[model samples]
Target: MADRSLESEQSWKALDGEQMSALLRGSLNDYGAPPAASAEASERFRLQLEQSDQDPMDAFVEAVAGLTDAVERLAEIAAKDPLAAAASIDPSAADYAEIESLPKPIRMTVRTWLGRLLVRSRLYDEALPVIAEVDATESIDPASSLFYRGACYHALLMKQEALTDLRTLLENEDDCPIRFSRLAKLMVADIKPLKEDSLDEISRLMTDVTRRLDLGRSDEKVEGQEQKIIDKLTKLIDKLEEQQQQQQQQQQGGGSSGGDPKNGQESPMQDSQIAGGSGDGNVKKKNLGDDDGWGNLPPAERKEALQKISRDLPTHYRDAIEAYFRKRATDG
Candidate 1:
């Protein structure tokens, strides 16, 4: 009885007569053989052809033939012309579908590539779903995904969601915040009214991240440790991103910028004069501590000055700027 049942199961899974016929037809098409006239002939032909054919693994080899080429080309575009690649919809969308169709380990490579791509294109929404799917199926560096996901949540003003992700990142990512916590702050500000505790937690994380990364420790050990700390800080930011924006808006009337806090609007000359200002007098009076002076400078001059400040400022502060730009570069 057991033997009969096993045979029955085997027959059930064996390709139906039609499926066998199709394989036989395909084999004939490939080998230029005459068509079979009966089901038995077709099945016999298919089995014989399958047994005599080139190694079955050859299909896998052929399937991956273009992989290296595609990867190299995509990497070049991502590195040399990220914006150009990101500007097109095909590369990003097709990449997801392609990865989903691939075998297990192959999909990991695709996921990582898509991760970097999503970041470069600022397609946060598109990236998140793929990340979630990858997480469901495989193990990856949650920190990398966390950074992008937090940024997306913050940008969309989903404070609670951002906070949850950021907090996890903070705990698990080492010193990631030493490079990407500003997004947390932005989201923190938006969520403060709903979860004041999250803001406090983020502030505490930021403070910790700042102190540890202080004084430009470029030694290898310090650098690696700093990274671990920064990762933790990123999680904190994500945790705070979900705080209530509308409530905060009602509570503070949208925050106070010395200029037009409402629109964040500043004239170009105002930007220039601020950047070109002497370290004293009106600039000193207007500057929000030293950061305001350099930070408020015109965008062009601010570039070099920011690099210099990165050396002089607290570790957390420099990381905050880094995170802001990292988020921008990745999310576009």
Candidate 2:
């Protein structure tokens, strides 16, 4: 009896390999889960990373990074959707839960991300308190702050105030947001318009680029980038020319033959385009690279960032990116 008891008491130290793999099989096969594929792929990549001898870490990092990145992207998307936001909330009352449970910096990071999400969702007023709280405690970029204020003003229909803020952005800003600059110009253009010289200038820029491309220089690296630049210029010229033609046609037809002032007008944003050396926040700031964000960056760094993002984007997207980012002076 004692010997039998001893045999029964022996430690079971091993797990079956089949069982280990089977345990995860369900999670692996969850075809509905977008995240599972990436997560499992990363796990496989990590295993490979562990076994390889040379340069394994590099491959491991490159491969497995997608798992975390996918999740992060999901998080950002969640932040934008009201349903997602509601789902993430604990639903508990705000019973003085101390944010300081984590380190102060980590807590601040959470608030900042939340604030950014709120901004994107157009919950401008709701976002103000959190952003203001952070700004009170820590330095943020003035431009980012200004942008937030401008967005709020625009949403609230404070057009003149928004315009003032935007013009302030234009004047005090040496390098501005390309998207914002373009939108502002478009809005202002609706009220005023390009001078004949301005139209000629745009035409001349495109002509110069076309000449270069025709000279067998288009395939060169510098020429390719230049071609991209010129493509943007040509689009602008085409639009401006169309507008010029319409204006001439209108004169001949005696002011659209008594049509309403707004009837058949060019889209308020159609003519003007992005400026050179504008802020990058308009395109890749959130998508790639990082910005401490508007109102949180230093003046010099903000100007530098604006300069970098002033790329000649595709014509179709120039105005959309602008309106999406900042309120224009007149339209705000």
Candidate 3:
């Protein structure tokens, strides 16, 4: 009997170039040779293939001829106009159905390719469902599936999922392609130290928000992300203000005890009589200052103070803080 272990290993081995070409030719002959049947049409697709250096996966995809020509066009569109490329990814479309009808190996490969294109276009939300259709272990190009899926997960901030896929890809480091290996390492490094709601996380959220805005997506989801960033910044500012207040109080406490003890301290017992107080609950505002009048700072000093407050923040923070205050001002 043949070595069972060797046979099992060969079963999972990726298809070679000749194997892919033979499979494509067999499918073309068996499936009635779609529109790429014409010599001119075939030549057109061939010329398109020549426009790019073919990686192993790309070469396999190119061999599918007419069936995947749409994928080629989609890739081109993604490179030029990502939003248009995003809109074109309808799995229910006839071309996709035609791809689905292909042989299992070809169909899975093509589907994975489509998912990869979606990820490349930064359509992480749409990419997930497409990527889900292929089982990486069963894919002819498992490395590509893992890498692209991990990328989608990374971009979407699905840290655990991204690391899971990336680590699995790295488990076969020697066998994995060097490109995938290097990228996987970088992605792992990025995901490892990420803590939720941190400045780093906030920066990633800002990037995502910017990307959504670039795609002309100012929906409720985008609004929510913007609001989240504002909330985090407000909390940070409040914390800083509280610390400043505590430091000021500490400094004042060191030199002061001149006031009467009874005036400074509150009585534990309540007074028996109730006095007439303002039934209208409005309160007067206090204008606090050093020995000077309130709101009387020179413009240069005020601007310098504001700059000092924000000096430690990221450069883009000035714009974001201004936008936050503008919204608050409008709302108030």
Best by lDDT: 3
Candidate 1 — which residues are off by over 4 angstroms? 1-70, 80-97, 103-132, 136-140, 173-177, 180-332
Q: How do all models score by TM-score?
A: 0.30, 0.25, 0.60
Tens-place lDDT per residue, model 3, 1-332, is: 75566444332344444455455555555655553463334354345445655665565566554455655665566568654654565665545555456667666666577778778878887788767667776566878888899999999889999998888888666568899899999999998999976667777888999998997899999999888998887776556555555665677775563455687843333566765645698758855757764433355754455567778878777666667678878989
Error of 3 at 98 (Å): 4.9
Residue-pair clashes per candidate, as listed?
Answer: 35, 13, 0
Indicate the worst ten consecutive residues by lDDT in candidate 1.
55-64
lDDT accuracy of residue 217 in candidate 2: 46
Clash count in backbone of candidate 2:
13
Specify the highest-TM-score model's number. Answer: 3
For candidate 3, what is the TM-score? 0.60
Ranking by TM-score: 3, 1, 2
The RMSD of every model to the true structure, in order and in angstroms, is: 20.9, 28.7, 10.5
List per-prediction Cα lDDT, in the order shown: 0.46, 0.42, 0.69
Output the better candidate (1/2) by lDDT.
Answer: 1
